[model samples]
Target: MQNLRRFILKYHFIILFILLEVISILLLANSQRFHRNRMVNTTNDVVGKVYEWSSEVGNYFRLNSANKQLAEENAMLRQQLSVVYDTTTCTYDIIKGDTLYKYIPAQVVNNSTNQVNNYIIINKGAKDGIERDMSVISTDGIVGVVTDVSRHYASIMSLLHSKSVVGVRFKNNQEIAGLKWQTNNYRYGMVEDIPTHIVLQKGDTIVTSSHSNIFPEDLMVGTVEEFYPTAVDALNKAKIRYATDFSTLRHVYVIKDLHKPELDSLKARLQ
Candidate 1:
């Protein structure tokens, strides 16, 4: 109270002058139609600006949750697609009973692109049904395969990893090959062992092949950017622009093969 009193005494003249000025301005504005209109417009303009800023700030804070919701919705929609389910009956007739895959929505908590064996960490883990060798993908394309998991988190072996390779095929001709990343560039990778006889062209779409049990067939991988012959073999290789940008990746869906256990058992028996 003493401090307040001292401050008021010290600035009394200045404060009174400001108050007088404000009163004079208000009186002038009230007396003149033009002044009053300008004052009203100025007040509205300031209030509108403050409201806009407040709205934008609120939206900024809500963006992350909104994105997570969208990712979950996308996972749901992807599960509903015909491609995720088998439509074949015993007689080669169309049926919709066989469900082949399930998508588990996850948020990318950590990721790396500039590494020999880059890995991605996701929010979903063993409890969410993420398992080793399960495929991870963005809405646009493949992201990686699940490698390690805890109760609430999982690690993904990113496609950008040097040892990583996905069995991809040309969308037009179904020519299968392996896509590998050694370029050390996250935006690009090479698909090698493409037979030279298979005519290659720029912008040719590449997709996951049935050869890979992990990823569903026909899932998009990337587009061919350039093609050239390898020195050792008659096979050709192509540089491709990856569909998923690892550098800015955020959301991913872990693909769970519904019949994976049966398939694994069959393979184990063969061995």
Candidate 2:
């Protein structure tokens, strides 16, 4: 206790000087409005700097989420680009008197290309005006036709299936034929019954024939890959390479023709 008293006595002058200095500064700030304002401004500046630093750190951490959202948006734009520039199908112009073209966009939930009787499930159904025999197509090319429907989902008969057949014609000469998959090649299908007199070339574009109501005229099917003349008959058979890559499909459009039933009834009466 005596040693502590001696130390305090020795430093008493220094401690008293510090206390006096603090009191002098406080008095100056309270007595002068200019000094008070200066202190307040200094404190605000420090707080403002701290807040700015914190906000920048938070934005840095959210960069990954922002990048993912941008990527998804870009992918959707690319799909739309393909649809707009596709030469096969006609798009709706929505003029005053035009009623020929109408399309409904949908997404694929399930698809199978390896099965014999392959099917594709879409997100649109009766609620969206989808029905049996409605044509399904992607931005690049034709996909299939709707075969079954529920309230909000529909099943489609894929073009890759062996039993699926579509009436198609050449774009150059309008020579019509039946297109069917052979089940061995997923990328190619067979076009049969084309007359031997029609001239053909490799890479000639083929499209859906207008004779049937299932698909509209000039809807792209594929390009001619190879062709051969029949051995015993005057007929030509050709292999077609599809424009759409069935293995990587995601978004598709369902086509519903409002006049389809009227057209069907007219044809039935003729028969």
Assess candidate 1 and give its lDDT: 0.78
Tens-place lDDT digits, model 1, residues 1-271:
9999999999999999999999999876563432111223344345435544554565566688658857786677756754655434323433346978888988776677886668777767677877778999987799988876666667778898766779999999988999999747999999778887887889999999999877999998999999886667888879999998887776689998988899889999999
Tens-digit per-residue lDDT, 1-271, candidate 2: 9998999899999989999999988876563432111234344345434544554565566568546744775688768867766534756453435376568987666677786667777666678988778898887789998876766667778898867789998999988899999887678999888898886789999999998568988888999999887778878899999987787666688987877777889989999
The most accurate candidate by lDDT is 1
The clash number for model 2 is 0
Against the true structure, what is each candidate's TM-score?
0.67, 0.64
Regions of model 2 farther than 4 Å from truth: 1-95, 268-271
CA lDDT of each prediction against the hidden true structure: 0.78, 0.76
